[model samples]
Target: MVETVASLSGNESFDVVVIGAGGAGMSAALFAAIDGARVLLVESTEYVGGTTAYSAGTTWIPASMHMASVNRDDSQATAEAFLNRAVGARSSAAMRRAFLDAGPKAVAHIEANSDVKYRARPFHPDYLSELEGSTLCGRALEPLPFDDRKLGRAFALIRAPIPEFTVLGGMMIDRDDIGHLLNMTKSLASFKHAAKLLARHARDRIGSPRGTRLVMGNALIGRLLYSLMQRGVTVLTRTTVEALHTGKRGVEGLTLAQGGERRRVSVTGGVILASGGFNRHAARRADMLPGADAAWCPGAPGHTGNAQDLALAAGARFGEGALSHAFWAPVSVRKRADGTTAVFPHFLMDRGKPGMIVVDASGRRFLNENTSYHLFGIAMQEAHRTRASVPAYLVTDSEGIRKYGLGMVRPGGKGLQPFIDDGYLTQASTLDELAAKLGIDKTGLADSVARMNRYAETGVDPDFQRGTTDYQRANGDANWTGPNPCLGPIAQAPFYAVRLYPGDIGAATGLVTDTNARVLNRDDQPIGGLYACGNDMQSVMGGVYPGPGITLGPGLAFAYLAGRHAAARAASPEAGHADAREETRAQTS
Candidate 1:
C-alpha cells in the first residue's frame, strides 16, 4: 500500500511538495493542487492535523468577509493599528504589511472556494485590558458545521481531545454561557440545547450521520479538508521529508521518507516546511527555557521540528532572535487513566479556589496565578531566575475545596485527591508540616496565613490587593461573603502542598519566515523553495496568545501562500532563476 519513488532522475516530481499536513500545510497543499499544479503533502505522523485538532478551532482573521457582513468593518488603517499595537516593534514593517494585506484575502479565499461556513458573533474580548482592535466575536471566524462521516478514514485522524465539552453551533462557551445553561435548567430551551448535543453524540455513535457533531477546531479543519479532497489534492499521510535538497544558492527539493525508505522528490516549484516545532524534544525545551527540563507540553506530540533541522543542514541561515519562545505557563499535572498525562490549565483552576495563595520559591506571593497561560508562564520564567526553583503554591482550605471549582476529575469540583496522594498537597493540623513538605519557611507561611486571615475578616486583601476588577474575581467563589472573592484564611487544620513547575502549551520559539511563509536567512533574504508554519515558525502575535486560534490563523494563511507561490513557478517552465545570489552574498559578506 506504500509507493516509494526512489529517485526524481527521470521521473516527474510533484509541482509542489508541502512538508507537514497540519491545518497550514493542508491548506497550502490543497490550494496549490486545485490550482492545476501537481502536489505532494508529507506528514510526520500517520495522520494529518497537528496542534490545531486539539484546539478550540477558532481563527482570528480580522476584517474577514464574515465580519464585513455583520458590520464589523475595518480598513487597512484599522488593521495596521491593531497589529502595531499588539506586536509593537518586534514585527518588521514588511511582515506587518504582508499579514494585514493577505489576512482578509485568506479568509475570503477559504470561504468562497473551500467547503467552510462562518457566522458573525462578536462578544469575546482580548486578554489584556488595554488591548485594541481585538473585537469580541465577529472578527474571529469560526467553522459553521461539519459532518464527521464525510471525513471517512481521515475522521480517525481528527482528535476528539476534549470530551464532555458541550458547545452550541460552533459557539465558544465562556462563563456567561455556563451561567445561562445552569439558569435554564427547567426551561424548554435548555432541554433543546441538551437534546441537540445528545443527539449529535448519539448519531456519531451509530454511524448514522454526523450532522450534529460539529465542534470548533475539528469542525473548521474538517470542512477545510473536505474542500481540499474535493479539489483533487492527494494527502500522503505517514510520510516525512528528511532533507531539503538545496544547491549552492537556494533549495532545490526535498528527500522524503515513507516506511523506512528514502526517495528524492523535486520541488522544482518549491517546498513549504510547515512541519511544526520541537516542543516534544526534551533537549530543545531544556536548552531554550531553563528548568523546562522538568516541564511537559500540551501541544501535539508529532511536532519535532524535523524540517527545522533539515533546513539548517541545507545551509539556511536562521533569522535574528529565532530562538525566542512563547506560551510557557506554569501548570499542575496528574496522571490520566491511560497512564499518559493531563495538564490542567492553571488560570482556570487556580482563580476559583478558596483560601488558595500562590507563592514563589521564596514562599513569597508573586503575580496573580489567574492570568492567561502565556502571561503566567512568563512570570514563572522570570521568577525562576531569582528564586531557588519555580515559585508557586496553591494553599487551599477544606471550605475552599467544597465551595470553589478546583477542576478535579469532575467539572467544577475541588481537586484534592490527586494532590494529596501525590505528595503535592500537604494537609497538616498545624501549618508547620505543610510548610516543611512544601520546602518553605514555616514562619513565612504563617505570616502569609495571618495576612490572608485579616484580609478575610476585613473583607479586603491588603497584601496583594486582589480583586480590583471583575475579570480577576470572575473565577472566584461567591460562597465566601467577603470583599475579596477567593480570599480566605488557610488557618484550618491540615494544610496542603503541591509542587509547582512551569508548563507550556508548546515551545513558541520556531524558525523565522516572511509574510509569504518563506524561510528567511540570517540576512532576512528568502531561501526559495523553503517555508515554515504552525509552531515551527515564529508566532505572528510576537509570542502573545492574542486570542483563541491566534497561532492557527496565520499558520493557515501563509501555508496557503507558500504552496500557491511555489506551484505558480512549477506550472510555468519560464520561472528562470531570478538570481538573488548577488544580494544574498553581499548581505552575508
Candidate 2:
C-alpha cells in the first residue's frame, strides 16, 4: 500500500530503497521484491511514473520472447550490429553488450513474476532504418492495455497522461484504437471496437475524471502499480531524500523528509537512484543546455536532479563524450485553460504526412520533414545557427489540415477558430498570405510550394529525399493514392501553419555507472552500495537516439541488474560486496 512520509516510524529498515518511482525505479523495486527483498519505493512527486507516464511506453528490448511473434528473423546479433552502426563510438561497447545480454532476461523475469505484460509491436521500426542490420519490426514492445480499476484507490497514484493526448473528455487510446476509431463508419470490426471503447468510457466517467480503460504509458504504469500493490511494496509519495549516509562499505542509510518531518532509514542492501535526470536542474540546465528555453521542455516535473546532485557530492562523476546531452523533439506550444503552457511534441503524426513542409524564417525547406523527431530537432538547432529557424514554420494546405491536422488542431479541422484565436495556429487563404503572417519571404515560400507540387507529380523529393526510408514511408499516409505517399501538393486554399521549437524530451548525459549499474566515482571505482538507472545513469547509447524506446530499454535492463545485485547483497552482505568490488574493478580496468 502507498503511504505518505507520516507512515514511517523512524526505525524502519529495508533491503532496497529505490529513490524514484518511474518505470525504471518501480521495476527495480519490483525486481527486488520478487527476489525476496523488502523494498521501499520513493517518489518526490505526489504521483508515480515520472516522464514515463507521459511517454508512449514503447520499449525497445531486442531478442525478447515476444520478438518471434512479430519478426522471427530478428536476432541479438542483428540488433547489436544496428546499434554499432547507429551509435558507433558515441557509447561504450561493454555497456551496450550488458544491455543486450540482460534485455530478454529482464523482460521474461518481470512477466513471469508480475502482472506487467508486453507484446511485440508488429510494425514499429528502428528510427534509423536506413542503417545496416536495422529491422522493419520486432525490437519494440508495447505494454498491453491494462484495466486501471484493478489498482483501486491507488489508481490516483499513477500520473495522468497529457490532457491534450486524450479524447472524449479523458479517454486514453493507443495506435490500434486510433485506427479503429478513425475507420469505425467504414468497417464493422472497427465500429464494434469503437463502440466498446465509447461504452466503457461512458461508464467510467460516472465516478472517475478519466476513463478506467488505460492504454499506452498509462497502461504500463497501471500494470506496474498493480504488481507493486500485490507485492506489498512500501511506496512513499511526496517524499524527498534529504541526504545519503555512507560508510566504508558505501551507502548505508538516507534521510527522508516529508510533511515537515524527517526520518533516517537504514538499508542493508543498497540505494538505487532513478530520479529521472537533470532536465529541470537550473544550474545544470544552464551549464549543459545553454540558452535552451525551459518552456520548450515537455519532460515530467520530478527530474530536478536532486538525487543526482546528492550522488555527485559523494564523488560520482558525469559521463563524458556524449553526442548530445538530451534527446530532442520539435514541439508546438499552446496555452491551456489553466494558463499553463502545453508543449506538444510533433512525433509521427503530421510531419511525415502528405502536403506538409517545415520552413525557416526565410521560407526555405531546411530538412527532410519525414525524419525522426530527434533528427528534426537537431535540424532545427543546426538551421538556427545559420538563420532564424528556432521557431520554424510547419505549413500545410486545407486538405492536409482536414486529413492529418496541424499541431494542436485535431483531424477534420474541427474547432480551429479557438486555436487561431489563441495564436497557437495561424491560418490564411493563400500561400503568399500565409508567408506574410509567418514573416517568411513570400517569393521563397511560393517557390518552395511550387517545388513540392512538382515533386508530388514526379513521386521524388530529390532535394531532401523525404520518403526514401522505411521509417519515413511508414509514417506517411499508407492509403494515399498519390505517386508518393509522403508527397502531396500544398495548393489547397486556407493553408495552416504552426511554429515549432526544439524541445528536450529527456536527459542523456548522467552519472557514470558500471555494467551492473553501480555508480562510479571519478576514478571509475564502484560505490559499493550505490546504483543508478534510467536517465539518472549515463545512457548506454551515449546520448544517441538509436531507436524507439532506447532510453527505457537500457533503463529496464540495468534496473534488473541493479535489483538482482542488491538482492544478492542482502542475502550475503559481506561476500556480495567483495565480489561486486572485484567485478567492478575488472570491468573498469
Candidate 3:
C-alpha cells in the first residue's frame, strides 16, 4: 500500500530503503523487492516521478533485446568504441564497460518481469552519429503508451506533463499522434486517426483531472509504479531523508522527516540514493553549474541534491572536474496567463526546421543549428565568452513560423497576434525591422539572411555545414523538396524571432561510485551498505550527450545493479558487523 508520512509510525526497517521515487529509485526498489527483499520507496514530494516524468522517456541502450525486434544491429564492442571516442578520457574504462554490459540485461529483466514495455526507435540516430562507433539506429528505446486508469486512485501521484506539450486543453499526444495530427489535412487516414485520438481524449477528460492515456516518460513511470504495487512494495510519499546514520559498518540507517515528525529507519540491504541531483540546489548550482542562476532550469524543484549531500557526509567522494558540469539545453522563457514563467526547452522541435537560423547579438550564425541541443547549448556558452550570446535569437520568416513554429507556438497555428502581443514572439515586416526589434546589427542580419538564402537554394551550408550528418538530417523537415531538408529560403515577409538562454537539463557530475553501483569514499574504496544511481551518481557518459536517452539508460542500468547487489549482500550470511568493520579498516589503511 502507498503510505503517507502521517501513517508511518515509530521505528521501521527494510532490506532496502530508496530515497527518491523517480525512475531510478522506483526501478531499483522493484528489482530489490522482486529478489525477495523488503523494499521501502520514499519520495520527498507528494508525487513520484521527478525530472524523468518531464522527459521523452527514451533510454539509449546498445544491443538491447528490443533492437533485434526492430531489425537493428548493435553490440557491446561497437557501443564501447563509440564511448571511447565520444567520452574520451572523461570517464573511466571500467565504468563504461559496466554500463555497456549491464544495460541490455537490465532492459531484458524489466521487460520479462513487469508490465513496462519499450519499443526501439529503429531510425533514430545518435546525437553525434558522425563520431566513430556511433550507430545510425537501435540505441534509443521509447516507452509504450499506457492506460493510466490501471493505476486507479494512484494516478494522481504521477507528475503531470508541462502544459505547453499537451493539446486541446489537456490531451497528451505521443510522437505518432503528433505525426498524425500534423498530417490530418493531407490524408483521410490521418484525419481519422486524429479524430479517434481526440475523441478518446475528450471521453477521458469527462471525469479525470488530466488525460488517462500516458505517453513517454509518464508511461514509463506509470508502468514501473504499477509493477511496484503488484509486488507489494511500500511507497511513502511526503517523506524526506534528514541524515544518514553511518558507523564503521557504513550506512546502517537514516533519519526521516515527514508530517512534522522525525523517525529513524534501519536498512539492512543498503540505502540507494536516487534523489536526482543538485540542479535546483542554489548553493550547489552556484558551485557546479556554469551560470549564476538556475532560472531557466526545467528540472523538478525537489532535486536539491539531498541524496548527494547525505552521501558526501557519509564519506562518499564527489566526482567533479568533468568536461561539463551538467547536461545542457537551450530554453525559451515566456510569462503565461497565470503570471507564472513558462520555460520551454528548444529540443528537436524547431532548430532543425527549414528557413530558421540561430544568431548571436551581432546577427551572425555561430553554430550548426541542426546539431543536438546539448551541443547547441555548448556553442551558446562558447559564444558568451567573446560576445553577448546568452540570450540569443532564433530568426525565421512568416512561412517558417507557420510551418515549423517558434518556441511555444504550435505548427500551423493561427494565433501569432497573441504571442506577439504578449512579447513572447517578435514579428516584423522585414529583416531589417526584425533585427531592429531584436536589438541586433541590422546590416549583419541582412547579410546573414542573404547567405542563408543562397545556402537554402544550393542545399549547401559552407559556413557551418548544417544538415550534413545523418543525425542532423533526421531532425530536419523531411517534406521539403530542396537539396537539404533543413534548408529553406527566408524570403517571406513578417519575420519572427525568440530569445534563448542556456538551461541545464540535469547534473552530470555526482557521487563517485564503483562498478557495483556502490558509492566510493575519498580513497576510491566502496563504502559498505551504501549505493547510489541516477543523477545522484556521476554520469557514465562523462558529461557527453551521446544520444537521446543517455541519462536514463545508464541511470536505470546502474540502479538495477545496485539493487541486485545490495539484495544479494543482505541475503549473504557473512554480511554482518565483522564484514563491515573489515572493509572500513581496509579503506582507512
Error of 2 at 174 (Å): 0.4
lDDT of 2 by residue, 235-297 (tens): 999999999998656788899999898889988889999999999999999999875798999
Instruction: Name the lDDT value of residue 324 in candidate 3.
Output: 88
lDDT at position 170, candidate 1? 33
- Selected candidate, larger TM-score, 1 vs 2: 2
Better lDDT candidate (1, 3): 3
Model 3 lDDT per residue over 1-589, tens place:
7976656567787889888988888989988887889989989988989988888999888888887766445778988999999997898889989998899999999889888789998678899899888877788999999999999999999988878988988788878888899999998999999999989989998999788889998999999999999999999888889989976567878988887878888888888999988888778888777563587987776788877888888778878657888988889988989988888999977989889998998999898999899888888998899998888999998899888889899888488888999888999999899999999999888988999999999999999999999899989988999999998889989889999998888889989999989888887877888999999989989999989899999988998899998887778736646448656776669
Off by over 4 Å in 3: 576-582
lDDT of 1: 0.63
| Candidate models: Cα lDDT each | 0.63, 0.91, 0.87
Error of 1 at 179 (Å): 5.5
TM-score of each: 0.83, 0.98, 0.98
What tens digits encode model 1's per-residue C-alpha lDDT throughout 549-572? Answer: 567777766766777778886766
What stretches of model 1 exceed 4 Å from their correct place?
1-12, 68-76, 131-138, 162-188, 206-214, 247-249, 321-324, 347-356, 361-363, 388-391, 395-404, 412-500, 579-589
Clashes of each: 16, 0, 0
